[model samples]
Structure formats: C-alpha cells, structure tokens
Target: MPIIELRTEIKASKEIVFDLSRSIDLHKISTEHTNETAIAGKTSGLIGIDESVTWRAKHFGIYQLLTSKITEFERPNLFVDEMVKGAFKGFRHEHHFEDLNGGTLMTDYFDYESPFGILGKLADKLFLLKYMTDLLAERNRIVKDFAETDKWKKIVA
Candidate 1:
C-alpha cells in the first residue's frame, strides 16, 4: 500500500473548507483536465455520511469508473471515504479540517493499493505515485483558491 499525506492552509472557516472539500460540483471543476464527472449517487452538492458517488474520468488516455462511499463523517472536523468499486485493489481517503487562528488547516490522507501484485508495485514506484500525488495537489489548489475567495459561494451556496 502507498500512503500520501498532504496538508494545506486555507484562509477560510473550517465549515466552508469542509463542505467545499466534499462538493461534487467543485470536484468536477477542479478535475476538468481529466474530464471527471459524477455519473451516479450524490452527483452534486456536499456528500454526507454513508453516501456513495460513482465517478467517471479519463486518466492516462484511458477512461475509468470509480465508486466511493463515505464511511465516516464528523461535520467540519473529519470524514473518510473508501473505494467501493474501482481499479485499485483497495483505496481510502481521509479528509480532516481544523480551525487554526481563524483559518482552516486541511489535511488529506490517501492510501491505495494497485492490482496485479508485483507489477502494480512497480507501476507505483515508476510513475503512478507521482501521478496520484499531482492529482491530489491540483485538487487542493482548486480548493484553496475557492476557499480563499468568493468563488466558493457559487459551488457551496
């Protein structure tokens, strides 16, 4: 398994950051390069506890579908989503938010394992890890841009 931990400081309230992080609409916008879309289940707005979303996206010149279910939720504090069905052997993403001097400190914990055993490990080491990390960084950049500006209202309101 490969684990990725990322932290971003956003100049916004924890509530705003938390909600924006789970917004399907915002995700679509952030991943426009990949042509990501929510194809089923909670396709819009904030995803709450136990809700699942099926996403279709183009990655590495290939189209893939992934479904994830929110397994844990604690409002503006924390949430966890795990893969229900996807191309991976297993995957889990945890989002955490905390108020820090009037701003929000957002953290992401991403864990994933690819299929095909040894070949998967090689792929991860060769390029998949960097690719996934870049995707997450891009997503966070979009979240930060929205949270620090008025653009968030368009998605969250």
Candidate 2:
C-alpha cells in the first residue's frame, strides 16, 4: 500500500475550489497529455456522492480503463472516491477542503495498492510512487490555476 498526500493553497472560496475539484470536464483538461476522458457515468459536470465515472486513458504507453465512484461527499468540505474497477489492485482518493485566510486549503490523500504483490512493491520503490506523485501534483496545479483565476467559470459556472 502507498499513500500520497498533497496540500494546495488557492486564493478562492472553498465552494469554488470544491466544485472545480469535482468537475469532470476540468479533469479531462488536466490529463489531456494522457488523452483521459470520461466514457460513461456522469461524463460531465460536478460529480456528487454515489456518482461514478469510467475513464479511458493512455498511461505508461498502455491504454487502461478505470472506474471510480464517489462514496462519500460533504459539500464544500470533503469527498471520497474509490476505485471500483481499474488497473490497480485497489485505490481510494480523498479530497478535503479547509478555509484559510479567506481562501481555500485543498488537500488530497491518495492511497493505492498496486497489483502483482512484491513486483508491485518493487515497482513502487523504483518509479511508480514518483510517477503517481507527479501526476497528482500536476493535477493539483491545474486545479489551482483554475481556482485562482476567472477561468474557473468556463467549467464550474
């Protein structure tokens, strides 16, 4: 099991940050390099509790399909999405938001278990961990970019 935690500061309201974070359209934008897209289940708009999305993307020179469901949600505060079906053995991503200096402090806690047991552990030690971390960081950067500017309106408004 591996856990990756990240905290990002955004000069915007929690509502805006929260909504932007859950916006499926924004996710597709952030992962454009991988050609990620929602192929089914709440393909557009902000996803709420109990909603699921199936994504198709190319990662590590291979194309994979992943389906995740929002199992928990608290408006403008927190949400949890767990992988129901994916390449990974199992994974859970929690999105948390807090108020700071009239802005929002967004935190991501991603925990995942890779497949193939020991081989997966070795891969994590070798490169998988960093690869996943960088991916999350870049995703957060894109979220921040939208949250800090008026650009968020195009997607979340």
TM-score of model 2 vs. true structure:
0.99
What lDDT would each prediction earn against the true structure? Answer: 0.96, 0.96
Residue-by-residue lDDT tens digits, candidate 2, 34-91: 9999999999999999999999999999999999999999999999999999999999
The best candidate by lDDT is: 2
lDDT of 2: 0.96
Location of the lowest summed lDDT over 10 successive residues in candidate 1: 96-105
After superposing candidate 2 on the true structure, give the runs of residues whose Cα lies further than 4 Å from its correct spot: none
Residues 85-137, candidate 1, lDDT per residue (tens digit)?
Answer: 99999999999999998899999999999999999999999999999999999
Clashing pairs in 1: none
As a whole number from 0 to 100, the lDDT of residue 110 in candidate 2 is: 99
Where does candidate 2 clash, by residue pair? none
In model 1, which runs have C-alpha deviations exceeding 4 angstroms? Answer: none
